[model samples]
Target: MLKKLFGLTASFAALVGLPAGAWAQTAKDADPAIWVVKDADTTIYLFGTVHVLKPGLSWFDEGVKAAFDKSDEVVLEMIEPDAATMQGVIIKAGLSMTGPGLSEKLPKESLPALAVAAKDLGMPESALERFEPWLAAMMSAMAPLSKYC
Candidate 1:
């Protein structure tokens, strides 16, 4: 299945005039990765996506475009929520319901580092107290990447 997908991708790349070394290039110059899964009853091609591209970046061509054009059904990871609705959902689901605050749950030594990171991200350290640990960590992880979007 993998070899067949690669053969099709390579053939399509040639058809579209991409250089043979296209696959060997760095990510900045190459297409995103994709995977194919097949059984007797169904075939699924999974696209690895960044969801948003930097302005002026162009990737929706060649093998990616060909796969999309040939797909029988398209499934997306999400339907984007409106800001207000999204905020409400996060408040409802992403907060600690009845546990020790985030700071209290952490080792005493880690609190200072967490506070520093939160402040550097322009988030009040106290605000993290209301979050579930996973949500807080996710927010911290995603903060730096927000500028890209």
Candidate 2:
């Protein structure tokens, strides 16, 4: 009885722990496009990817497998950084320091809109003001999408 209960509990946990949208689409059915360039001495292939995948998506099938087998290297848009290097980058990017703040630097006319938007998202305007506009915008855009991964 204990063993059966343990097995059921394990299965439940595994199902719950899977990423959201894990069963949305299989690679075989999803038509992702790839660009290829080939010549006598060189071959290049480019494919867009979401950078994460569910466990069962057989994406590297047949043609992709062949191309990967022939390729000497795979290049990614951004290499994964180690923890220390990432921390150093965050510090260098001015995220760690408390300065004059993002409100002061923004044109006086924009502050109200910024505050309203921040409030709508359940974030304090000051929390976002520390980062540059581009970074702040990117973070806001990514907030919803981050949960899936």
Candidate 3:
């Protein structure tokens, strides 16, 4: 059963133009297209949705709402972990205790800027001390998304 399910999943992933291991990323600028295959008694459709959209867009028209309403079932492409699960994963990943302090890792000249940014973000400078550079960068990039998400 597991093998059959995995094979079915791989086939569907390929149908959607995603290679294996690329499911977590998206091509943001691709032209949108829908593919359909139909036979005597069956039909399969493949479509894409934008990964992230800002609020208050005027593009979702009545036709779009009707298409969604007419569908018998819907499948979402991703699963977001709840806060507790996210906390557990963060703990497992050691995001709170990686290595040398971020301030110490930065050049002496950059510490003041880092501290200022941290203060602006309402984070104490010491709070981010243990995060590696890449993690710190990702967190900073998440500030905009954090508001609506």
Candidate 4:
């Protein structure tokens, strides 16, 4: 029947969508570690690095240093994401501390989990109460991601 064909098509679309969504969550070429792999004549070194280096100490791997010193140009994720850009994204991403902010945007169910995690770390919830829920969620997510970023 026509109904059966429509159901099959919808199911197929749902199956195809998951990978695309996962890919969207990850950085395509942004990982710093991938540059370490081999290939071209112009060697691109992505130095694996510690998340937090001790004061006055650094791990500049030879290959990475060579690439940096040899290269005529350097680029970062952005020239700078200055105040205006930050404010704009805060507005757009709903990171504002006031109004509905990130609080209303998030599923109500996740709040208890967030509170528990913050408390477990001894990170006071009261201090963070004014922060937008989106920002809080990001801080929670990004804590583990510091190494990757």
Q: What C-alpha lDDT values do all the predictions have? A: 0.60, 0.55, 0.50, 0.45
Give lDDT: candidate 1, residue 2: 32
- Steric clash count of candidate 2: 0
lDDT of 4 by residue, 1-149 (tens): 33432332233223222221132332233223426435766555554533332223324435455777977666543332444454445445533446653335558897787677466434655544545665565555534433322
Worst 10 residues of 3 by lDDT: 12-21
- The TM-score leader among the candidates is 1
Between prediction 3 and prediction 4, the one with superior TM-score is 3
TM-score of 1: 0.66
- After superposition, which runs of candidate 3 have C-alpha atoms over 4 Å from their true positions? 1-52, 58-78, 94-98, 107-113
Displacement of residue 116 (Cα, Å) in model 3 is 3.3
TM-score for each prediction? 0.66, 0.56, 0.44, 0.42
Task: Compose the digit string of candidate 2's lDDT tens values, residues 4-123.
Answer: 323322332333334333554554444345789989989898875644444446455466667778889988676646544543454356342466677777789988877775664456
The predicted structure with the larger TM-score, 1 or 4, is 1
After TM-score superposition, the amount by which residue 91's alpha carbon in candidate 4 deviates from its true location, in angstroms, is 12
* Backbone atom clashes (below 3 Å) for every candidate: 0, 0, 0, 1
Candidate 3: C-alpha RMSD to true structure equals 14.2
Which parts of model 1 have CA positions greater than 4 angstroms off? 1-30, 107-112
50-84 in candidate 1: lDDT tens per residue? 54344444565588878888899999776656544
